[model samples]
Each structure stands twice: as structure tokens, then as C-alpha cells.
Target: MLEGKPICGGVRVARDEPIRYVCADCGHMTTTRTGRCPSCGAWGTLESEASSAPSKRSVAARVVSAVDVRPPRRLSTGIGELDRVLGGGLVPGGVVLIGGQPGIGKSTLLLQAAGRVAGTGASVLYISGEESEAQVALRAARLGVASDRLLLCCGTDLEGALQNLWDVSFVVLDSVQAMRAEGEAGWPGTPNQVRAVAQRVVDAARAGDVPAVLVGHITKDGRLAGPMLLEHMVDAVLTFSGEGYSSYRMLRAVKNRYGSTDELGVFEMREDGLIPVEDKSGLYWNRSDAAVSGVAMTIALEGTTPLAAEIQTLAGPTVFPYPRRTARGIELNRFQLLTAVIEKRCGLPCSGHDLYMNVAGGLSIQDPSADLAACAALASALRDVPLPGGSCWLGEVGLAGEVRPVTRLGVRLREAARLGFSRAVVSSRERNERVEGLEIVAVSHLNQALAAGLSRKEA
Candidate 1:
């Protein structure tokens, strides 16, 4: 019908077939009817478009399925610790998200990852929206990329950068915060803009089967600076957590969709690059024999690896009306809980004292097994007595002052034994191998643990 000619006040036209749809997902159009949009492999979200161009995914899926990907692509991070967290090596088409605080080396880690990927002779396209082309080149110089497989693009437009996906296997978005589409009004990294741009980038990746790694910026509150959907959209979320004060940085896999989330990659930030810390236990336990006050070894787990860390506590008379409580690498409530236990059970005057605790190597020990170390540290400080240098503590301290056992006690015990700790204290029922050259102290209750740790100190 002609425009405005119908008695119903609307023009109408009849067609033999349903109109072709361009999937907002893959941005590809199809006339075929199905619940799933074939262009981008998304479930739905298809609009009108006319295109006869067959999908590259379909064509490659058939022929490439016959070829073995494992034969050609091999992952060698050059950093052994990073390699371990990644589960042997980087798999093709696997998306990884790396997040950190500002100036915390998010870009540096990717540059290092790029060097490692390029080192394996894999072609990598590094798309930088934050930095000028020249700035990226300067960083590359400092990074020292020896492989010729690395490609750099300093363009801010996602559509332009994605056009080169066929030539490269992996894409590194230096940062998703700075990318913007043409004619988009809102600022880059805003909620609406981030969602739109992210969807487009994700669509392009899915359609092209190109594995993309994005560096996401975290807000000042230490949370991801985008819609919560961003975290759900990614395959894995890695947090590069460390203090700016120290050169030691840790690569912890906070979330992994396809692998174990508990894995970790430890690195040391140096003038050259991020050096992987392979033997983390050795680093934390190096001064085990120094007889340092306010320090005690605690065994904990990062993913599956069991390691020992030195927990330090400082106690002194409060100088102000409000007692000071400062904690690092551990939760504040946890320290307060231990203090309450010590005061209620052991009768230590911890309520009026200022308390501070630190986990060595700038690595956070979240496992409850470190509770005993925390209590021992507090006791040592309260008594003004140093904890024995050759002693390491484990076991969770309960409200009623009982030492609760932890899992993988054997691993923690072995680590303590390996580091030459002369004595190890844990819950009575814990599973630990009796190793030579060390004394293992199994305590049934909190009083026993405190007594054993303090008895030697006062004597």
C-alpha cells in the first residue's frame, strides 16, 4: 500500500518471505529462520540487513577442524610462574581479563605477555587506545620484544582495529577504558559506552574466533570500573594485586571459567621486567633463622600450592583515646577477632593496645590456617617476647579458644619442614607427614598453642 492511502491510516505491504536480519551480535545478516543468530553465534538480537557473504567461522570450522591446533601453537611465557597459573600455556580462543589499580603495571603485564606470546612465534595484535603510537613504541623498547610477530595499532576506533583480525590470532586491548565508537556521544568507559563497545568487541571476537585479552581498570574502591556484567562476560578474571611500595607483584587468578580459580602467578617488578617468583616459599622464608621480633611464619594456600608466610605483629600502649588498629595483607576484622579471643581466653590486655600485622612478600594469606600465627604474633608482642625463629604456626583459632584444623595440612607441613622450621604447631587431628629434622607440635586447644609458643620464649 501507498503511504497514508489505507483506510486504517497506515501504509502496508505484503511480502512472501520474512525480511533478512542483521544480527547486532555478529553484525551479519541472514534470511534463514532459527532461534540462534548464525552470524555471531548469539542467541537472538537480529535486525534487518541484506548480505550474502557467508560466515568465515562456518568455512573455517569445517576445514580447520581437520587441522590440529596443538601442533603449531605452543605457549612459553618465559616467566615460569605466570605459565603455571595459566594452566601449562595459553589456549587459542581463550579470553583473559587482567585488572589492577592505576600505575600498577596492567600495561606492563600485557607487554610482558605479548613478549612471551611473540616469543613463541605467535602473531599478536596489540590495540592501544590509551597511548599514542609513539608512546607504545617507547614501552615496547623498555619491554624488549625480540619477536617480529608483535603488531601494534594505536587507533581508538574498535571497528578499524577489528578489520585486521584475520591477519592476527590474538588481540590485546591495552585498555578497554579508552576505546570509543564513531558518533557515540558518552565518554569512553562510561556504563552505556562500556556495555555497547564491549558487546561489539565481544561480537567481533566471537565471529572471528580471535582470542582477545583486555586490560580493565579498577575504580578507586578496588572494584572493576564498569557494569558488573563485564566480569560475567569474560572467560577469566585475574587481579594483579600488590603494594606500590614493594617490587614484588602477584598475579592471582581470582576467577577462571575454564580452569581452577585458585591458581597464582608471582612476579617481581624490576628495572628489566616482571620476573616470575618460582619459589615463593623461599622468598617469604628467607630470614626464618634471623630471630626477628614481631614476625612468625604461617602456612597458607594460594590456589592449590601450600606455602609458608611470615606474619608480623606490633603491639604497644595506645597513645590516643581510640586504640589504633592497622592491618595489611589481612582483613581487619580477622585481627580484631583474634585479639578478642586472646583477651577473653588468655587474659592478654589486647583491648587497650595498638595492633598491626603484616603478611610477608606483600601476598595476602586468606586461609584460616594462619590464625594460629596471628595469635602467636599478638602474644609475642603483648609479652614483649620474640617468637622462636625456627617455629611456624597453623590452625584456626575459634571463639572459645580451640585450634580448628585446616585442609591440606600435609602440604603446609611439608612446606614448613622444607624451609627448615625446627618446630611446627597445628591442630591435633590434622593430616601431616612426620618429617625428619623438625619437631611437629600438635595442640588440642588454643591455650596449648599459646603456652607452647610462649613457654619457650619466656624461658
Candidate 2:
């Protein structure tokens, strides 16, 4: 009898071809018979009892639900807001990796996550492989962390840190780059040291049923410091992203092995520490109200929610042979394309227009849903008029100046409607020709849409 371990178990017997599957690691093939991979040496890449004989009983192993695994003992990082981003709460024995720019709140976030999880009665071992114990305690005191369960260990030695920890179910290594393995001679943050130390700690956590969190440093070019492959090795990759100059900090989940990757946790940095943005819309509206030129409300989508953010555009005739195009959150050529479409579709004659766009409150508008908003703002600034009150804008403006439809138009409408927006300028394909209870203006072309916005403003 030939015996071999299955990559993930549940194999089949087939006609003499040798049960085969490709390695997810190196793209190497296994005949479901090899004990260890010859090409990459990665374990669990072969199937169990996959016979090369023809015609055998076939049984399937269904994929197990996440719930099938026992619930991880959640550790509340005293920060309730950060915890929510971890999907209800942190899963026991789950390793989380957080990266950010220098001094952009990696320590603050981990300390906060520590305090919150500690506050929830879970033990938290904070291994500050970067800063000294005195420095960590000083910062913790300043951050108002008084939890007794939050244990602080100041060490840069990877093996020592993990060995000293016992019965402690949660570990946090601030800035994984700072820790070096026992025999590693590379600089602390070098690629070799970072990968070896991080993996060793992560493996220790899983073996001991302890969840570990690692804070990471960024490259000179703004990428997570260390090897690029390091990011792919973690259970989750979260980044504290935003303009470093702004108080608004966004916890964006780029890769999540456990939850929805697109999910984000918003926060505001204050002297008191990082505060969760509970009512993002309300925070968005924190800016004072004024009918300023080049300013308009645009609906932008963040995951499932459509945000009616303020869009500010500046238009002045350019005298240069080649007009300059500068934008922040919105794309540059996209702005240029929309402007060209506006001229061709609406005959707005924006040839002399110098358009600058800003998504209000320091937030980014990555979706095309803001195309019409850009057009509307440019129109308002160009025509020197204030758009009608209680009016909202949606849909993307195509290169031909047509109002292109978007996904989840109904949600956009409902969001606008809930905000007491009396009228919504939407693309034609949203609903039947008309929507009930609210006035919906459908435009299939960009010119018609521009005319709609310009008409009410001109009126």
C-alpha cells in the first residue's frame, strides 16, 4: 500500500494517470503520490491515497464554513473601532499584520487595539521590538492605557520574546522590522530578518493557540518596509492610510484571509488618541456650509454605502500652450477625459477651463460615480451659479458625454432619498422610467444631464 499525506485531504482514485494537482506555491505538479514537493519543498501539496487505478469509488470533501472552526477567543484592543474592522472582533490565534508610514500611528493603533482587547478581559502581550520598555510605558500612559491585562515586553530578540510568553493568548510585536532572529546578522529591518522573525512569531502563536499582531514599517517609497513577499504571508494586511498631514486616518484592509477585503475602519487622530469615525457622513458634513463657487455635493461609494461628499472644482482659463492638469484623490487623465467629454457632449466650451477637483473633508473618491459631480462642479464654477437646493448627482460621464450607469443604483438613490434630497440626477437605466415618492431625472446623454444641472442653477 502506497501512503502519502493529502495537501488538504479528501483525494480520489483514477485511471492510472496518477491523481495530479498543481502546487499553489510554485505551480509545480504533484501526482498525488509524492510525500514532499520536489520542486518547492512546500508541505500539504499532494493528495492522500490517490490511486493511479481506473474506476474507484469517488467521494467528495465539502469545504468547511468559517463557523465550522471554533470561534476564536476574541481579544478586544481597548479600541472598539479597530476591533470592528477585525470582523465583530479579533479571532483567537489569528495573526494580523499592520503596516504604515513612519510615525503614522502603528504604535498608537496597536496600543489602542491592545488596550481595548485588554479592557475586554483578554490578556495582551505587547512586545515592543522597536521602542524600549520605558518608551512604550510612557506612550501608553499618555494614551491613557491603564489596563492590567495589557503586558508590555520590550525586546528585539524574536525567540526570546516568544519563549518568555506563556499562557498569554495574544502577542503584539510593534514594527516587525525591529525584531531580529537569534542568529540573523542582517540589519534589524532587512528583508531576511523581517521575514524570518515575523514567520517564527506567527508560527509560535498558532502552535500555542495565541493570536499575534505585528506592526510593520514602510519603505522609502511608501511600501511596507521589507520584502514584497512578506505582505502575502500574513492572515490579513491592514494599513493606516491617508494624508500624513491630515487628522483623518483610515484603516484600510488590503488583504484579509478571514473577512471582506474591501472593508475599512475610519478614525480621526486627536491628542486624546485615535477616535473611530462612527457617523462618517456626519464627519463628512463637519465642514461649514457655504454656496462657494467650484463646490458641489457628489455621491461616492465606500463599499456598500454611497457618501454624498463635497466636490470642489476650480475653473480658470489657461493661457499656456499645454494646460496643466493637477488633481489629488480623483485620477488626472480621468478628469481630462471627463472635461473633453463635457465639451463634446454639452458644448460647454471648457477649452479654456483650468479644472481642479477636491473631494471634501480629505477623503478620496476612487469611483467613477463622481464623474457627473465633477461636471456639475465645473459647470457651477463656469456659469457662476449655485445648484438648486436639495438636489443630488450620481452616474459616470462617459468619454462621449453620455451618463453611464453604475452598480447598485438603487442604493445610491435610497441614500440620496434618505438624506431628504428632493431630486436626484441619475442615469437612465436605474429603475423603470420613474421612481416613486421622489423626483428622479433620468438622462441618457451627458449634454442632457449637464443641461439639467445647469437649468436649475440658471433658474
Candidate 3:
């Protein structure tokens, strides 16, 4: 109908077509014109773009016959702990992401590795986006990094650094959160920018066949502070965890495309930098001359390395209606379950006591083999009796109070023997291989284990 049919002269108005809005924070796609991103609720982070291109009807592909291939050569970081966590060493063209809390020595460890690599006549690039050149130089000097082949570059100019990436044998990005792509719409550390920067850096490293290590920041919740895609884009993800003020730090591999993820690395922060802990068992044990109640030793295996940890439990009479149970370095639920087993199976009255269990040396233990040791400690604590001296426990305690066999029993016993433990309380089903100096006190039930592990009371 014509506008002028019944009313005064009227003109048609024009409207602009809606543009596609993509969230720079979470990469959420939508056509909404809201000022705030409907996905992540980040204001003004919606970037406008032209309509998406038409989907291609078809694409071509090439098929090739499968062939056998040898493993890639690994470049050692010269840090034993780091190397172990990385399953030997870094692979050429492989990208490794290391995430940790702020001031947790992420930068310090990488710098130390870079220096060691440079000392071997291999050129290394130290890219710093969080710190300026002078600051890095000062820290390097303080750390005694005097390698001539190490080159330092400052700023978030990732493109500029990639230009000379091939010239260096190794590249270490101080952090991925601080780096940004040249044309990315979001600010540095944003999901879009972090994803883009990580992809480009990974591509450059692969294309140049250079090993790259990227230090990442951890969110308050302890996850890597970036898009989740960043973790998937890398070849391996190593997470550094420990108290901020503690001298010890643990590096664990969450993902490894080339090796086993079960491997772990332990390092002690010293004045020089992070140093590998060679004797891990000695880290958690305090040897004494006399037998002690409420303290039992156990061997926990990390990858192939056996670590001896002391399990100490204290059980005291509780006045509260419900007895209190506190656990440190071990799961609270697990401790509670063990207590129930002891109370029901061994006739121990732990239900009316306040129980506290701690793994010495502040190291968290996940090995189920520690169950026997924990049981022994709890029994010793409740009975006010001391366990036999020079004895270590290694077995899993089942819900039925049966001592269950654990994996690598031989390996664990060997480690205990090496650490001066003469007797071991293990599952009755374990092999009776006669070690030169160690004795296996195999027991089928928790009470038998307690009897074998704990010495009898004086007559």
C-alpha cells in the first residue's frame, strides 16, 4: 500500500543489517546487539564481523600408506627433575606448557634451563612479556646465568620474536598470557588472544623444529589462566604445585603425547635456583634410633622411583559427641575409611577418639599401598604401642580388612631395603623372593599386619 494513500506525505526509513557479534572472552558466537557479552558477561568484548562465508560443498584429501617411525630425539633441559617430568627431555618441534601460581618460580626454572642449554653452545631465546629487559637481566645476573649464547627479548611482540625463532635452538616464552597476536581483537590474556598467541607460537615452534616451553599463569582456582584450548594445543602440559613459601615444588605431567604421564619431578628451591631431589625417599623420612608409636614408614612409587614417606597418626580420647578426624597430605575420606576398618576389623576403639594423620615432609601421597602403613600407624597410636624398628609397610587394606597385594611390590621393598628398612609388612600373596638383607613379613589380614608390624607389649 502506498504511504500517501490516506495520510500526509511520508518517506521510507532505512535500517542497518545486523552484524555478527563474537565474544572475545569465551569465543561465544551470536547475532545479539547487546553491549555486554551474553556468554561470559564481559562488557564491550563482543567483536563485530561480516557474515560467515558460505560453507564449502566439498573438500579434497590425500591418502597415504602408514609407515613405521622412530621416536623423536629429545633435547635435555639439563635439569634432571624437569627432564624426568617431561619423560626424559623435550622433543624437537614439541610445545610444552608449564603452569603455576604467581611467584612460584616458573620464570626462574625456565631461565635456569635456558642458561644451561646455552652453556652447551646451543642458542636459546628468553622471551619475556611480563618483565622488561633490564629486570630480566638483573635477575639473570643474580642467578649467575652467564651463558653467551642466551638471547633475551622483551615485550609482547610475538610476531617479531617468531621472526628469529629459527635462529635459536630453543625458545622459552616467559608466559603465554602476556603475549598477543598482531591482529587479535581482544587484549592480551583474553581467551581469543591467548588462543591465537598459543596457536601461532606452537606453529612457529613446530615449523622451525625448535623445542618451546611456555610458562602459563594459574587462575585462583589453580587451573591454567587461559582458554582451555591452550592446553589442548600443546604437546605436553606440566603443572607445578607446592606451597608458595615452601622450598619444595612438585612438577607433574598432566598430558604427554610422547611419554607416560605418571612420571613426576621433585625440586627444592635454593639460592641458586630449582635443584632436583636425587634421594626422594630421604626427603620425607627422619631416621631415629628408637622405635616410635604412631609413626610408620611406607614406600610410594612415582613412575619408577620409590619414595619413602612417614605416616604418623595420633589418636586421643575425644569429648565431642562426634569424634574428630583430621588428615594432612592424604585424603580425609580415605583416612576415615581406614579408621572404620581398624575399629571394626581389629576391635580398636578409634570411633571414640580424635584422630589426626599426617604424611611427613608435606608431600601428598596417592598410592594405595600406603594403606597398610596408615593402618599400622593408627593402631599404634590407639594402642599406645611402638611399631618394630627398621620396618616399613607396603600393602593395600581392603574393606574386608584383608591385606591386598599392590603393584611393584618388589620395587618398593628394594627401595625400603636401600633406605635401611630391614622388615616390610606386605600382603600374604606377595612373592617370597629372598632379598639379601630385607625380610618380608607377609600377613593376610589387617590384625596380622598390625601384629607383625607392631612389637608386642613388654611382659
Provide the global lDDT of candidate 3 against the true structure: 0.86
Candidate 2: C-alpha RMSD after superposition: 8.7
lDDT by residue for model 1 over 1-459, one digit each (tens)?
454233344535443334686544344556776777765466655545444544557543455555564542534555667666766655556667788988778788788878777777778889998898778777777878746788888877888988877767678896887888766556888655565677677777767777778889998898777665677677778888887678777787777765687887777888777877767787676574566567778878988787778788998898688888888988999988988999999888876788888887676778888898899888888888888768888899899999999888777777777877788888997765687777889998888988897887778
| Collision count of model 3 | 0
Tens digit per residue, CA lDDT, model 2, 138-179: 887888875788898787777877886687757888868888
TM-score of 3: 0.88
Candidate 3, poorest ten consecutive residues by summed lDDT: 1-10
Error of 3 at 120 (Å): 1.9
lDDT measured at residue 240 in model 1 versus the true structure, 0 to 100: 89
Tell me, by TM-score, which candidate is best: 3
Candidate 1 Cα errors over 4 Å, as ranges: 1-78, 132-134, 182-187, 282-294, 317-326, 347-356, 360-362
Model 3 agreement with the true structure over 387-454: per-residue lDDT tens digits:
88888899899999999999998888788878898988888898775666998788999988887665
Q: Which residue pairs in model 1 clash with each other?
A: 22-47, 262-303
Q: Which ten residues in a row have the lowest lDDT in candidate 2?
A: 1-10
The positional error of residue 271 in candidate 3, measured at the CA in angstroms, is: 1.9
